[model samples]
Target: MRALVLLACLSVSCLAQRPQPCTSPALMTGDLYVSTQSEKLTAFAKYMYDALGKRIRLREVGSYNNKTFELDVLLLYRQGVVYKINHKNSTCCKKRLCTKFHPLEIPENASLLGQSVLGSSSGPGQGLLVNNWYGDLQMKKGTAKYLSQVTEFGCVPVSVLYHTDQSGWVVTSFYNNVIGLTDPQMLYPPPFCQDARLEDEDGEDPETFFSLF
Candidate 1:
């Protein structure tokens, strides 16, 4: 009886120690590595996020249309505008940003998969402990789902796998070297973008568009 009682106590203790869902910081800067399976494209970018101000910026270098390209994308949700600047031609295009701000956070309805160490845990402070969570994204169009791995302590996003019927199932993003937003100006559109021509809106759903990246 005593042995059984001890096992029950241990099980309860483990359950109590499980980490809960969490939200990320309001201001953050990081490197984003993205892979799109359908396009056969891989991109490396520096990202700036301001959840409080509903702004995001990405400076990306990748291959597009069989050519190497460098682009800067600025999303200003509050102003409902997006700026896409092509470095090779020094041209910018302005489009309507239909999506709302979506933070790097674990949804409250997400199911906790498990807890594990990202690296070797045999030594002290040698590995990061993370929580894996999976959930379906609530979208207005096609089906969407996501799996996220975040740090157990600060809930800092480590990686995410997002899928949608329109875009296919093989988009992955890795986030690293993250820190608090260093410069507020990084979120603003560059001076050259002021003369950007407005493009015709494609009538894409806001939720579907945001989930692509």
Candidate 2:
């Protein structure tokens, strides 16, 4: 009878204990979307903030030959970060496009750049360029090389610069003169980018990141 009583007490004590509970659920944390230096081009700015390891979809508000198309970018966060200390740059464009030299305008129907900067003054975000009329991209240093063009809205002194070679376009947005990057493929976010909008989210440093599988 005593053994039975002790067993009963032990059973009760075991029942009183509870399994360990999860302290917290894994969550993705990032800053809320904020306006970058350029007011007209905030979408790209917002993208830089939310694009880490996620996908990006872009739709030009205007119509092209009555045919509207959307651009998709898959952002991969990387390890290295672009921290800009201080930089200065000046951009200029010819009223007449140098398109004859640079025929590589992304989204052929999209004319969001005529000419612009190639790299960002600070941050992985490329610098600014002067654009006008149709957004056709022209190389910096008056070269005849056309890269990519960005067609967002903003009248800030400088324009965003999007460029690529064999890879796809690397979009850059500016806020308060700050620069960031947004690449759907998780391109190498420049290590010294200041703009939060242009950094690659999926693969901040692709090599450092490992897959669970």
Candidate 3:
């Protein structure tokens, strides 16, 4: 009887520990700090989610080694706007690039629900399994695509398992990333160029964030 009771208690504890989504939309607007590490490199990301007006503004600043990248996206459900800035300052000469994309298109079935913003969990395993999906634009090729996956645990996002795509797969884990919201932006693109805007004349680049690492 004690063993059965302990098993029930453990099951309840496990369910309670699973990451839960914010029940309130107001709670969804904040900053998410995500850090990732691979065999050869590490990346840190700061994501700002603002539920402002009738649109959602998502800004991301990612860094690895000497390369830094920024993404500013305004989402209006099925359509949105995007701005990308990538800068590198090292012995390879300082280069800053900015690309502007207006009326950015989203997939017909794009959605952001059941995503973990501020949560954590522990289990009787080496790591957790998770899934993720997001729309990303290729900085160099000026392309965009929806990358979806059901792989392993990692935090750029704590988990992205609410999407409708099931064909993508990858494995990842978090080095150190936090889930939360922020008001003032933390990281931003460097101030070197003023009007370095370019239209999306070359079409969208076919690069997903998952494919990079």
**Candidates in order: C-alpha RMSD to true structure:** 4.2, 24.3, 11.4
TM-scores for every candidate against the unseen true structure: 0.82, 0.18, 0.31
lDDT of 2 by residue, 118-185 (tens): 56656645665444323343334221222223322223322223322321232233333322343432
Question: Residue 16 of model 2: what lDDT?
Answer: 57
lDDT of 3 by residue, 1-213 (tens): 999999999999998765432221321334433333231222333334333332334445555344565544333322332334444431111122233322212233444323322224564554545533456534333343444332233223343211112223222332233334444332222354234443544533222232231
lDDT of each: 0.76, 0.28, 0.36
Question: Per-residue alpha-carbon lDDT of model 1 for 1-213, expressed as tens digits?
Answer: 999999999999998898898997878887877665467556678888888898888877776435566767788989988887776676788998776677878989999999999889999999999999998977655557888888998888888877777555544455665667877887877777887877997743222123364
Candidate 3 stretches greater than 4 Å from native: 1-44, 53-80, 89-158, 162-183, 186-194, 201-213
lDDT of 3: 0.36
lDDT of 1: 0.76
- Model 1 lDDT at residue 72: 77
- Candidate 2 segments whose C-alpha is farther than 4 A from its true place: 1-60, 70-72, 75-157, 160-213
Model 2 clash number:
51
Error of 2 at 170 (Å): 15
Clashes of each: 0, 51, 10
